[model samples]
Target: MNRLRFAPIPAGLPATVPFTGPETLERRSGAPFRARLGANENGFGPSPRAIRAMADAAAGVWKYGDPDNHDLRHALATHHGIAPENIMLGEGIDGLLGLLVRLTVSPGDRVVTSDGAYPTFNYHVAGFGGQLVKVPYRDDAEDPDALIRAADEVGARLVYLANPDNPMGSWHPGHRIRAMLDNLPEPGLLVLDEAYAEFAPDDAIPRIDPNDDRAIRFRTFSKAYGMAGARIGYAIGPAELIAGFDRIRNHFGINRIAQAGALAALQDQDWLNHIRAEVAAARARIAEIADENGLTALPSATNFVAIDCRRDGAFARALLDALAVRGIFARMPGVAPMDRCIRVSCGPAEELDAFAGALPAALRAIL
Candidate 1:
């Protein structure tokens, strides 16, 4: 080898990044967005108590956070009626996903997820040199049985399912999902992403043994708690698997201010209830807007609605582009069938008003 030569990057690395943030899009467009409803962020925002707690914790920024996450772990355990040993906290579900991928995946190892599900998990799996095998959604909802069969056939190291899924906002009853899981082949872990659980029905959440070693559940304060910026998320699973995180994770990743915010957010049940009501109202309004625009809105179990563009993927893409050009931020699924719909997150009235005002112009320009 030449002395001047340097090591090259891996040949199998992905050529494209997963997503571009809204800010990046704005910078490219040279116009600020009037509505920020594409990201599924709660525009209603965090609870007053959470704000106060974060403000109080701001003074302690000079010190490093507790590596064990002692207080937050204990608080979460008491809240969920599970032992702290069963809990694993991380920067967010995104970081935890990377840790799990490292723990389970090897070069060329098989991993299963829905074709158009969360892309971040797939990114992590690919980063670890795992092969991703995806199953398509049936009627906009993940075909759980099909995914399980695929996982078994491939001897998958991980199976990813997002309840009340992103982009589509579709969900199956918890019992139905549980039935599928009961028949799922062992020797593989089922990673259930419950990021939007709080917005779903009470029965939408599966009842699982947190001590079960075969599976893990991921939850986030980002979605329902209005703490997306806080970067707080957690995993619930068997003590052994939960402990695996400590070995790979950045121990003090969760900042003290975030912990304080999340704790207060969790305690403010009334604020959460209010936000839920607001989301429900926003969903209904979105449905009405869709109907008025000669489209149909899918039944949603999360803080977003998927409106059928009533056409092919190209038409949907055109519509989305039109919306973006008009300063309305929105998104759609990555594949066909689902891609025929545009996903819009529920937000405050002003944001919805922006969407409503722009729909007709977007449709006219695109159609």
Candidate 2:
């Protein structure tokens, strides 16, 4: 019997997801996590206004979301002081990245990123048959110089960087990022993932020309805005590059509720400021907890903290597993020496108390 055939590209790809959701873990363990802190989601949740917006929009579920995402895109443009033509909305940064990889990468095309950077981006590159070139992180931060050099050396079509980076919770200042972009080789597009930009300092976020075609910056409502479940994000780039996303993106991928929630969330700057303060306090509390456990918490600009277990990756993994068994869900980086640290997201007092209480026992168990 003949079997259905897949395209050569997809047929050769591995069946894998970049992340295993917390719900999947709970199912496998046959228990709920006492503190859900592993996924970097905003446990604080979106603003009451955003919540109300979603509820108000729920009645319109019978109608599809605006395929053009006109209102949200225009709102985002106004928020960023750019023209609507310079923005493109998608399900999330993850979804937008896939579309970007699709638009720019072809079979055997070269792409560059820091080793152990955002794995989802790498996954997309691999799925599209793009050759990935990885530069090692320098001192736990993405080495911009090395990345630029690698892109030039490989004649890469795209390069990826995340400011206030994930897993390790490190960051590069805005000017340095600008220098990296300036030095990027001709024909290479910089994919700057600023999903955590809201949590970063103003100086760390570079000012880019809205009409500049050298880079495309991706932002999401998922992090500081507390709209991860809504699956709404947008990209900022030159009009020409932004227009390319429409060619391949899922036209109606963003639902009405998501668009409403995101729009409402964007309008609530006061709420965003409140969340920022809350996250800052939570980070401090996490650091204090780490100190109590004789661990060092790295300084973070994002909503999560990476606590150095002060040992090898094996030790960190053992401790992370011990915490999981105790019903406190947390995560560690997938690669070393970053893996020597365990990452915990900022949460309210109650959720963090669960972590603070479980950590000592988890460490003792690992020892």
Candidate 3:
């Protein structure tokens, strides 16, 4: 270890990007993927209104984004039935999570989460020198009771839970979540990631107060809005806690174009409804394809499916590799038990066709 270090946490931690993006894979192979399905991006894409707004806003790129994120925050407040003071905006949920860690986590602070949860949150915790207490998932779904139990035992200050969770794509009902919150011990702040809530049933999202002092819920425009590149996300929390973000947040982090596009996307509910139908159809197709190839596709509320390879992590990895070799970009969970499945993002019929066509061949090679 270096005697004179600026940030000791980063100095000791491995330098890595949590997720290997599709473009990076393409560059390494010197060939582009046939179907981009690894990242759970909306293949249906943003609404026409959003696209037009972005194009219009693009001309004003010279101006900085609203530091306070006023208009968008107000619009979101109206949409969510909350006060403007209760919200905070950032580049993305990932960025906002980092800020939350930076603000709340001192050296050695304990953070609790599921064993095979969103790795990005773990990455942020590590960066801030927080100790993560991970609990195991119950039957491929994130276990709220188990997580709460671990948090209380550890006397954790923070707990991360992704509703309509990533990778596994399973979620519990709102009542279970509310009960989890009710049982969470004092000062154990909950980081509720609702990135895929738009795709989930309404009952999956808890009806929590916007000013719940013990929780901050995050939402993003990247998934259902199909604007992952825009990097627009926001969090709802207690007014006082939301104000604290002003102290350390990158005020102008969200670009001008992204803000306009997000607002327009929010207005076009019809387009969102259409995308939902498309995602539903694609999910069915994915299940059908998996059944045809003698595989089991887990029921998903998120914009992706985790198909069980009926084997170990190595087998699932081999299947992913086979799919990659066939020019289909896909991914798998990193931790065990959950890692026995490969994640496939929901997309349009054409993209799903590519995945459907590649699955049997990929399986044959791996098997």
Q: Which candidate tops lDDT?
A: 2
lDDT per residue (tens digit) for residues 256-288 in model 3: 999999999999999999999999988988899
Consecutive 10-residue window with the lowest summed lDDT within model 3: 1-10
Question: lDDT at 193 for candidate 1?
Answer: 92
Give the clash count for each candidate.
0, 0, 0
User: Could you give candidate 2's per-residue lDDT for residues 1-367 as a string of tens digits?
Assistant: 2488788999898888788888998998999999989989999999999999999999999999999999888888888999999999998999999999999999999999988899999999999999999999888888999999999999999999999899778899999999988899988999999999999999999999978889999999999999999999989999998899888888978889999999999999999999999999999999999999999999999999999988999999899889999898899988888888999999988999999999999999989
Ranking by lDDT: 2, 3, 1
Clashes of 3: 0
Candidate 1 ranges beyond 4 A from true positions: 1-11
The per-residue C-alpha lDDT of model 3 at residue 75 equals 96
- What's the ranking of the predictions by TM-score, best on top? 2, 3, 1
TM-score for all models, in order of appearance: 0.96, 0.98, 0.98
Stretches of candidate 2 above 4 Å error?
none
The lDDT, on a scale of 0 to 1, for candidate 3 is: 0.92
